[model samples]
Target: MRQKMLLAFAAGAMLASCGESENAEGPEVADLLFSGGTVYTVDGDATVAEAIAVRGDKILYVGSAEGAKAYVGPNTLTEDISGKIVFPGFTDSHAHLPDGGDTILGLGLGGLTSAEQIVHAVKAYADAHPELPAIMGSGWELNLFPDANPNKALLDEIVPDRPVMLVAADGHNGWVNTRALDLAGVTSETADPVNGRIERDAEGNPTGTLRESAQGLVSHIFPKPAVEDVVRNLEAGLAYQAGNGITATIDAAIMHDHNEAAYLEVSSRQDLPQRVRLSLLAAEEMVTSMVTPDNVEAVVEKLVERRAQFRAQAKDRLDADAVKIFVDGVPENHTAAMLEPYVNAPLGPDHRGEINLSEEALNAYAIALENAGFQIHIHAIGDRAVRVSLNALEGAIETNGERPRRHHLSHLEIVQPEDIQRFAPLGVTANLQALWHFNDAYISELTEPFLQEKLHRWIYPAKSFVNAGARVVWGSDWPVSTSDPFDSMEVAVLRKNPDDANDQSWIPEERLSVDDMIKALTINGAYLMGQEDIRGSLEVGKQADFILVDADPYKVLPEDISDIRVLRTYIGGRQVFSAAE
Candidate 1:
């Protein structure tokens, strides 16, 4: 038949490419050979191959099964991956791996939809671990509660004796019981810190809700997790990522001083399964103090020193070449800086949120870091914040000359039309959380009212950026959102809540194609992390990082993408995870 003839020709081509003798070979040679599957190369041509061969940690050949057989020696480990789909291992462009791990191990509040569920879960956890000195947890959404603000009295009703503090889903707010507030000495007179707020009642009493930088007040009182605990949580997180098909991730914000050491220790012991890029926290103090002209030089010098120290102690598995900066807070808290006035400001109609760092200061800081050979990753959640971040990066590029390093702006929740075009020309990466572009309770209840008319116009302009020739990358911002790439991809393409598929798609015009979403999760993420040449695609000579899926994402309905589970995961020619095993 014609099919048989085509197969034979493809096999012949593979044999020719491998340069192996079919008749004289005692035994072929390769560390591993995977055959009989649809291999998505994700290369320039997006070629689909029938088989692939790996030698040690590198891919030796990618073609037909006949070609791969040439490299199959006596020691080869072969896998017959029939009726499956293979893709380049996913990379979460931005995530809080350690925090996610900690949350999983501690009080997990990931998917609860109501206060009753959260309270019941917390109470159960507290009862199970009565030996603990204090209780700490996160993953509570503001929109889940009435008025988008959680009350401390609810937490007090459960753990009236032991102190309890739970962080908001966004990681920008915190809720604590009365005992926790007392433990932190947070009285009504405890003035709010710069760039942070302590939400209070009408009577001027502390409401037990802390926003932005103010969470540090109570956090400082909580006992730090032991080093072993930290490592254990990190490993748990890495394993979770691998199970979900992630081979690489960037720890977006390294806030604690000991986190760097923990990462280095893990990398040295070869326990880290995924490639990790760390962006150290440089925004908290710098944003508050760097506004003064005299303070800019000192702040930049300090950042440069931190970079040098990290690089000197860097390991091969972990990279520390970027710094994370927060431009403003989230819109739910009314802290995200906006160019125009908020629709109904509590203080006044003219109030338009707050900007942590001025435009000039951000520009200077970016320029200094860019000149010192470092990439900048900024969190700009509002329209004005996004514009200011773009302007700062532009100023840096103009002043320091365009370098190979590509700067990133994350959480593009609201980007102006004019700013959408700036990304391509300035070579800026739109690091977006695709899972957020949907009709979720957070969007419909908490965020939409504030934006008023601008709500539809400014929410996640992903397609616009891609059309403008800008490289768009995807991230989960885990511990803040779901880290599953499938979940994110589904939202990106469908523009609807994956949990409630029947819900109407929000801003469906901005939806992306499956192909574009795949690129954002794989190649684009790799490029953002500066690992494009070595990984990202399933090409020969690249690191063998890939995963086997239960179904083909391209062939299935877009809504079913998130339902397709990862059957197996491989890195450096070694099997790292398997559903069966």
Candidate 2:
């Protein structure tokens, strides 16, 4: 009797009467109904409905709560969502998120912002677990050290006897101690790999820091965790994403074959709740040791096999059909390939940093990958890096002609005006990392000075890309930075630090509209992974993937958008994450 009264009251708040005059047989009953809430249906018209109805895994009706009542028969489950806000579930287009779960299981270094804090935390973790022979942890911020570089002495002071490996929050660089280096036998005589760096001092001795592929040398030595341990971390990470209102992810890196086992193990248990599109990475060794005109056939064959293997064995929504290319490194380390030299050129006057592969080689590789049916996802930061990656995609198109592939480029940090227009014509999606658009400590301290005023103004041109008719999308790059979609949407709309929430924007003209951000966070991202036809929006026939937040983003101030909390997340009309629980 109480439930009936509540439902009747909620039905009063329903939208304008749609099919209110039901006939003799009555209206079709829906299995589930959500009413008395603001539903931001990110559809073609951007409809704001008072109720949404679902039957099984697909959306049945999205109209007035009064209309919804006709579908709410005795067997229908009803939710009176008064004062709540609903939106399509967010898709983190590009992220490395296994760390989200791994951090919870063992030693985590997320919030430590100081070097002293990090070293002591490593020492404390080492002390607490003396049985471990090596210590490994991530989430070290770049602003904590000079030029995002760290050496061994501080860590050596703490645990000189044990092997210590601390990875930067961005996952591009690594810090190690003397013990680990000695174990790897990386002396001054050890030459840097083709696409990596082993930071050294004036005397050419290893400074205990590794960048790019160089970290792989020592990281391969760490003992592998048990299969069950990996499955637990994978589950925890996926749930963490769901808790943040994310229903899908384009996992930006898959370094080895073993990485597949844990994800497969979890999927076999029917525990996989989110859509994952893994981007298989090509290491420096593979390009140098295996790729050539004569051996390219075998290289292409291996790539195809791996992509097919992941797609074929799926108990749940798990897939891998994309390839990842690190065209250059980040500017903080002076490894990003730029058209002009960085201010005061750290390496040399004419130096513009590293380019992992020659343009010729990249063109060949791109053509092969595309011909073999793999979408390419390139990491290009500097202006020159962006140009070269674009050139490679252009070559792929000319060689293989056009099919249906959503090839994309991530981290367009310093795109030139000419290249900005090239993205749409060449058919590449500008996968914007919107969270980094602001003038934070990292940008204020190192980035501004490094790029200077000239090139710095061109940073994260969100509106410009959209104006150029390029399909733009946003990503969290989690484990590198914050993964909250609200935090990211806030930054994209304000072009200022969400935490600061100040009036002084980074580059005001680049600020996106609220509608622009919602589209990027939803449909645009789904299109990038080829799932737009099924999900990405709330409509009559689409999958029931959406979230209920604490407040309506449209009603809140731009600065307060980050304060919106995810109350409940639903995928396939089934509850996956609930904050109240």
Residues 1-581, candidate 2: write the lDDT tens digits: 00110101111232443222234796667888889988877766666788888888888888787778778888999999986988888889887756667776777788787988998888889999999989988888878887677888888999999888888877778899999998988999999976678999989999888987788778867777777777777777788899999999888877554456676555444446688888877554311122444555676777787777666776546677898888888887778889988887567677787678777777888888898888899889999999999998998888888688789999898889899999999879999888888888777776768775788789878999989999988888887877788888777877776555334688899987777788898989888988888889878778889999997666677777778899988888888999973
Q: Relative to the true structure, how large is the alpha-carbon lDDT of every model?
A: 0.80, 0.79
Tell me, what's the RMSD of every candidate?
A: 5.0, 5.5
Q: Residue 127 of candidate 2: its Cα lDDT?
A: 94
What TM-score would every model get versus the actual structure?
0.93, 0.93
Clashes of each: 5, 0
TM-score of model 2 vs. true structure:
0.93
Badly placed stretches (over 4 Å) of model 2 are 1-26, 269-271, 284-295, 501-503
